[model samples]
Target: MRRWASVVAALALALPGPAAAQDPIAVPSPILTIDQDRLFEETRLGQHSTREIDAAAEALTDENRRIEEDLRAEEISLTERRGSMSAEEFAGLADAFDAKVQAIRAEQDAKARALASRQEEARQAFFVEVAEILSEIVREEGAVVILDRRDVFLSADRIDITDQAIARINAAGRQTPAAPAPATPAPDPVPDPVPPPADQ
Candidate 1:
C-alpha cells in the first residue's frame, strides 16, 4: 500500500499543472492591414519628389522649345543660302545642317537619360522613408505580422491602419522644409550699345 501511494503521488506530480488547462496553440488574427500606395502617396518624401518631377518636366519643355527654335532657324538660313550657292556648296551646307541636328538629338537624349536616373533615385529615397515609417508603426501596434491590403483577400475595417499610416508619414515628412532649389546663374549682362560714329 505504501508503494502504491508513492507511485500515485509521483504520477500526479508529473502530470500537467492547472496552467496547462488552457489551450497552448491559439492562432492570432492579423492586427492590421497596410496599403502601400497610400503610404507612398502620403509620405513626406513622396510629396517632395512629385514637386521636383513637375519642375523638371517644365524645364524640359522649355529646353525642347529652345531646341526646336534653333532647328527652324537653321532650316530657314539653309533655304535662303541654297538659292545663291553652287551644288557643292549646297551639299556641304546640307551636311553641316545634318551634323547640327544630330548634335541636338544627342543632347536631348542625354537630358532624357539624366531625367530618368534622377526620377528613379527620388523614388528610391521616397520608398526608404516609407520603410522607416512602417517599422515605427509595426512597433507601436505590436503586430506579429502586417499584410499589404493588396495581398489580402479580406480584412475587417478595424484591422486596416492605412489611413493612420498615411497621416503619420505625412506629418513626419512635413516637419522638415524641402531643400532649396539650386540657383540658376543669371544671364550675362547685355553689352552696352556703342554710339554710331557721326556721318562724315
Candidate 2:
C-alpha cells in the first residue's frame, strides 16, 4: 500500500499542472517604444488642432486673393490716368502704390508667422495634456523608459504604444479647443490717385 501511494505521488509530480498546461505568460518589457508623430497625428486633440489651423490658413488665402484683385484693379486705373498726368506726378503716385503693396505684404507675412507659432503652441499643448496618460502607461508596463520609435533603429512591433496611446486619447475624449481666429484687418483700399492740377 505504501509503494502504491508512492507511485501515485510520483505520477502526480511528473504530470503538468493546470498552470503549466496553459500558455506561458508574456513578460512586459522594461523598455517600451512609441511613435510620437503618430501619437500626435492620430489623436483627437491633434486632429482638432489641425482643423483649426487649416481653417485659418484657408481664410487667409481668401483674403489674399481678394486683396490681389483689388490691387490689380487699382493698378489698371492708375495706368489709364498716366497719359493725362506729368511724369513727376505719375512717379510719385507709383512710388506711393509700391509702398502700400510692401506694407500689406509685410503685414501678411507677420500673420503667417503667427499662424506658424500657433501651430507649434498647439503641438506643445497636446503633449502636455497627454503626459498623465503616458505616465500611467509607463507604470502599467513596468517600463523604465519610453523611447521614441523613430530614434530606434530596430524594434519589435509589440513594443510600440502609439496606437494604444491614440485609442486612450479617443476614449478619454481629449480634444483641443479651437483657438480664437486672429483678427484680419481688411486690406486698406488703394485710395484713388489724386488727379494732377491742370497745366498753366
Candidate 3:
C-alpha cells in the first residue's frame, strides 16, 4: 500500500492544472442575475410583511413572559400550601401543575411553528408577485435567462436587475394583482459535465 501511494503521488504531481487542460468559457451575454435575498429584504411588500411578523413575534414573547410569571407565582403559592395540605392532596396538586406546564409548553411551541409558517407563506407570496416584474425585465433586456446572483461565479454589474425589480414592485403599489402559485421548472440533465480534479 505504501509503494502504491508513492506512485500515485508522483502521477498526480505530473498532471497539468485545470486551466492548462481546458480553456475557460467566457460569461454568457444573454444571462442576467438578481439577488433573491435582496428582493425579499428591500421591497415594500417585504418590509410590510417584516413589520407584521416582528410585531407578532414581540406579542408572542410578551405572552410567554406573562405566562412564565403566572406559573412562577402559582408554584410559590403551591409550595406555601404544601405544609397545610394532606400529603396525598399536595401530591395530586403538584402533579396537576406539572401536567399544566407541559401542556402550555406544547401549545406555545405550536404557536411558534405557526408563526414560522406564516413567514414562509409571506416570502412565497412576495416571490410569486415579483416573478411578473422579473419576467418583464427579462423581456425588456432580451435576456435568455435570469439566474440568482448567488448562483453565478462572475458577472458584470450591468446584468443585475435586482434594483429594477424592486422599483417596479414598489411602484405597482397596493393595486398589484393577487399572487398565484410559483411555477416549478422541469429538471434537465447537464451535457458533458467535467468533474473538478480531486486534491492529492
Judging by lDDT against the true structure, name the best candidate: 2
Task: Give the worst 10-residue stretch by lDDT in candidate 1.
Answer: 187-196
**Residue range 1-200, candidate 1, lDDT tens digits:** 99988987887785445666354524333467887766656666577676777688789889999979978987887789777867766776677677667766776666766677776666666666567777777777677677878887644555678888878777775433233343344433333223234346
RMSD of every candidate to native, in Å, equals: 15.8, 14.1, 19.4
Task: Compute each candidate's TM-score over C-alphas.
Answer: 0.61, 0.74, 0.67
Over the full model, what C-alpha lDDT does candidate 2 score relative to the true structure?
0.82
Q: Identify the leading candidate in terms of TM-score.
A: 2
Which candidate do you rate higher for TM-score, 1 or 2? 2
Angstrom error of the Cα, residue 43, model 1: value is 3.4
Displacement of the residue 27 alpha carbon in candidate 2, Å = 4.3
lDDT of 3 at 99: 74
Clashes of 1: 0
Tens-place lDDT digits, model 3, residues 17-57: 56654754344348889998898888888887777788888
lDDT of 3 at 40: 81
Clashing pairs in 1: none
Per-residue lDDT value at 40 in model 2: 81
